[model samples]
Target: MNATVNPLLVPDPATDHILGPADARVTLIEYGDFECPSCAQAAPAVKIMRDHFGRQVRFVFRHFPLREVHPHAELAAEAAEAAGAQGKFWPFHDLLFAHQHRLGEAHLRDHAQQVGLDMARYENEMRDHVYLQRVQEQMQVADQLRVRATPSFYLNGAFVDVSFGLAHLQQAIEQALAKG
Candidate 1:
């Protein structure tokens, strides 16, 4: 029998930003960049997919900032980590994608405030670049996976090409659901 082996490895829940049930049948992982327009476009669709799938699918997001092209992406990802430290990761993440065009220092601060993160803590972490290594580690995982672009997705531990359109993602999810 010819079966496609799942190439993507399972991400650590302790370190990864995940949504939905831990025991969900399908796991969807996205390696994204805040400054990537394609990632911004996929954000809402990801949310919708999570909502629609409910407990059936678990979603995880990892940083894969293409720093050479996206000048602010690395810092923006760092800010998200600071927010995560304050237990506001999801909200801050949504805000980052919502305002992808405005990812400067000031804008990141604004997002931190909007998410109700403790300003002092957020500022301190950002200043220390505490999350830089975490972000870099995630990027290294992306490199290992040969993920060349923002918004690359892995479903049920297998890579799913969404470059054509996110509709393919939905189709893949549906197929996964059907199989189970």
Candidate 2:
């Protein structure tokens, strides 16, 4: 990676969890926690950006689960990764956030079943702690990036300092698009 590259824009060392169009002109990388209220609030804005921008922009979600604030965050991230093994990451991810209050181990299992994942495999993977290291690696990267909040974003390789609202995201995306 380039020395000048913003840490937030760097690909996470954990899972290859890149989201959005590959050839998009603008890239928005978000570092968020599954249990963070702010991140939960930002979810819809992210969806809107994806819906509106379509192929014009790319969005990447990286884990920055603040375990101190949200004890079940790491578990949530692991559950998502486990779901990824079955190509159901996004569905599981949305489910986690949508039911943040109910994210216990059993709930994770229920989600896995609801998403049509093999229960045996999901339970085995979850027990084996397959994705824990990956989730921790992402958290370490978040530390390197100095991400201290629930929802922090980097747009077009630059750190975006603002609230995680649709207008703020739109303005940042527009600026990034204008730059190119």
Candidate 3:
């Protein structure tokens, strides 16, 4: 929160949804919500950062659904976890952000299907709310870290404020890579 000062509270790799190599020098973690507009904007920038940084940076996404504002966000996060259970987290994540306006129950099922998850299993898990605790745990971690917003990013353990614009995020990534 204090502009590159706060370190990540939980940088656990085993439980995170990681993109890029595990051994990458720079670790970028995003505490994000599916229905957040800012987070949706950040999705593409994150992809660009991954492409630009190649294997130099590893990206992790942690769920931080702001349920007060985004009614469907929490369930969407749960849906994403279900997709992740089927090895389709990133694709489902993309679809959710792409169609941010349509995060209703039906749309979540549609996205799950689009990501090629086993429909029967996905529905069962979703109905059972199997991944709700996982999602809530991540949100608690974000709260512990004092993350009050979606798309709260940390590069190499330091918070990277993308409040002004995502260019700041790119700059932080560049600076982090330069530090190594």
Candidate 4:
């Protein structure tokens, strides 16, 4: 028997983000905040999953920036989307997670520079309020999906039924693969 598949596994129109592969046996959709310690902690686990699964799995990140707690969270999400405009989203994403503690406008600028993006262009994009709207749209999608906190994930479109730990993620991936 074959597992039920979601067409949304490829590219999500709401977020304008693409997963790794259309036919990937496992798909992970993560709703996260840049400044959330839990999300930061989960980063290495996500890396391990990517390393272990390779092309067999796909990962998609959605913005669920918890503004009430992390003041700069929305800004970080905007920055990532702005970088996406220049085809540098992932680099910006990794940098944000890597420097989760030091997220500020100045830090965002530094990351743009570190990622080898044109500072002038990145600055302009960041200041553009339109891109921020896009990030808000992503947040709305997360809310509709009932994502309550940082580092919540959906494996193959179903909520992961455990804490956001690496071992739990690995187990979810294994289950997804088995279903596939």
| lDDT tens readout by residue for model 4, 51-159 | 8889898788888899999999999898888778778888888889999987899999888888888778788878876588888877877777777988988787777
Residue pairs with colliding backbones in model 4 are none
Ordered by lDDT, highest first, the candidates read 1, 3, 2, 4
Indicate which candidate wins on lDDT: 1
Q: Of 3 and 4, which scores higher on TM-score?
A: 3
TM-score of each: 0.95, 0.91, 0.93, 0.90
Model 4: lDDT to the true structure: 0.79
User: Which residue pairs clash in candidate 1?
Assistant: none
Off by over 4 Å in 1: 1-8
Residue range 153-180, candidate 1, lDDT tens digits = 9888788999899999999999998888
Clashes found in each candidate (C-alpha, N, C closer than 3 A): 0, 0, 0, 0
lDDT of 3 at 176: 74
Q: Lowest lDDT 10-mer window, candidate 1?
A: 1-10
Please give the lDDT score at residue 176 for candidate 4.
Answer: 75
lDDT of 2 at 132: 93
Error of 4 at 27 (Å): 1.2
Poorest stretch of ten by lDDT in candidate 3: 1-10
lDDT for each residue of candidate 3 in 1-180, tens digit (9 for 90 to 100): 123544444356666899888678788889999999999998998899899999998889999999999999999999999998889999999999999999999999988888899999999999999999999999888888899998898877777888899999898888777877
What's the residue-level lDDT of 48 in candidate 2? 78
